[model samples]
Target: MLAPVLRKIIQNKTVMIERYLPSKGNLFVQKGDILEPFQKLGDCMHSPNTVYFPKEFEPVKFLREKVYFQKGSLIGKIGAKKVTADENGYMSFDEVSGEYFYEDMPVKFTLLSGLWGEVSDVIPESSVLIKTVVAEVDLVACTPNFSFGELVVFPNPTEILEKFYLESFVKSTEGKIVYVGHYADLDTIKKARDLKISAIVAGSADPVGFSFAKSANIGLGVVSGFGKLETPDFVYKLFNSVAYRHVFFHGDLGVLRIPMSGVEEETVSSKKKKTPLKVIKKVTKGQKVQVLQKPHFGKIGTIDRVSVSSIFVRFDNELGPVEIDLPNFFIIE
Candidate 1:
């Protein structure tokens, strides 16, 4: 019988990533240029403190292009009401567009390559596309968001230890993607959000906490099924080995991507000559499977025997082989 195969982890897959700025910015790399993870790609002046005024508003003679103004400084009027600058910035009037705008001091933002790759394409003053090889981990459930940062893997924590674990890294957690252990509770989710963490990955999460993450727009990815399930041993070990590596959390695609090294890319290129990995296969004895139902949800076991519509699986910790319906488990390839 043919069964669906779930790929928990895939290694050395080539992908293209586009890194862009919020506004028009400089591009430093050209096509075919090789880049390292720490390489600087470009920089931009980002201004989020801009305000617009009605076209009908009249401005003082002193309100000229590039004229600096401080908070509460009056520079114009809309009929009898006087308009003041809300923050310190330069003033400008666009005659062609008939628009008045106040912009605060722009913040300088530097862009990093973030991966080992070759520049595949570049859009001037906007974005750069890099072709790179990476390792991908499938997530069963995830919030619909996108985030990229250094991956932080914590030791599996008990309920009481969760807070302490978070506090230990409080200063370094901001803008990072962290693995919060076997299951994430509501308190853990709240603490992460407060710390300004970019996103969180867990083995499983409380449905309530998962809902909160979605509503709050925090990126959350679950590797295993929900409700108090342990992270599969293999997945946990893989994450532990790659702590502090640059990673991408694509919640919409339900995958975590970790860029691979140049040597790994070479190995992948060599393997391209071989047959590709399979995503579906015939059920057989001795195959590894992950249970999707209660009693053994998220547990991995080896198939001992295959029946007409069920398979008998043997768990290392269980006393005897357990019969599982075909639909309740999937082959882990």
Candidate 2:
């Protein structure tokens, strides 16, 4: 029983995005191929590449810092006998590609080249890409003090960001998310001064609604498309922010931007959940007891439960659990 319940909870939920430090941004260069003549760098800052972010980029995760970038794809490995750039206002990179070292590296490029160039693109104003994991544990084989490996669910990632704060899970918890679901008012934004949740998931921030998970320093994601708003596009934007490299899709469906570790699933054996308490002693195996003003002139009823001093019983015609006071209490059957 517990196996199925736990499986359902884990299966139905998708983190979609995880938070990271604010992107320092990334390095990018124009001139097409790496060997393009350095003079062709007519303000390489004008060119932009498609950057894919991780699935957890929004909603679940935040950028802790602003992003930084380099001019060329080569990361600091240019060889010894190379010509360095000192006048183009570009920086030098000692980067090794394939086999040889390339020296000159550009300094900065437009952070939003693709965003600005593709007039038709409906880039997300904000979003996040998250990674997910399915953890398995043998309920029967483990005790309260036992290890479930990596089964501990992550905290409400939104709580870790500066713009967003965490809330209590039990106060009016909708489910497992501790600090989500209901949110405080934007006027209370100052109240978030001490919160630890990440940025808000964009667009969903309606302080007036029941589902409004208020966003603060934490990230909040929203939907955006070429001309409309769509959930998938909103998610994709997060991936681009992840991969300033614009290289491979982390996922098969042209979805990359995330570097995931320990993403594999595990198998485990489990057992059913038993009732908290069982019948300890009974006067008869099947004969349930009843208290009456007179032994034979009473009504028949069903035993709902028992306590130290009384038994809460129910009858076929009754509306609710009825208490029967008794000097001593125990299961009759």
TM-score of each: 0.77, 0.19
**Top-TM-score structure, candidate number:** 1
Q: How many backbone clashes does candidate 1 have?
A: 0
- Name the lDDT of candidate 2: 0.26
Candidate 2 worst ten-residue window by lDDT: 1-10
Model 1 C-alpha lDDT per residue in residues 1-333, reported as the tens digit of each score: 778887777765458999888778888899999999999999899876788789778877645567888889988998999998887888898777778888987899889999999999999999999998787888999999999999999988988787898999999999999999999999999999999999999989989999999999999999876888777677788798779998999998899988877776565434232237676889999998888777888788999999999999999899999999978888875
lDDT of 1 at 197: 98
Per-model clash counts, in order, read 0, 81
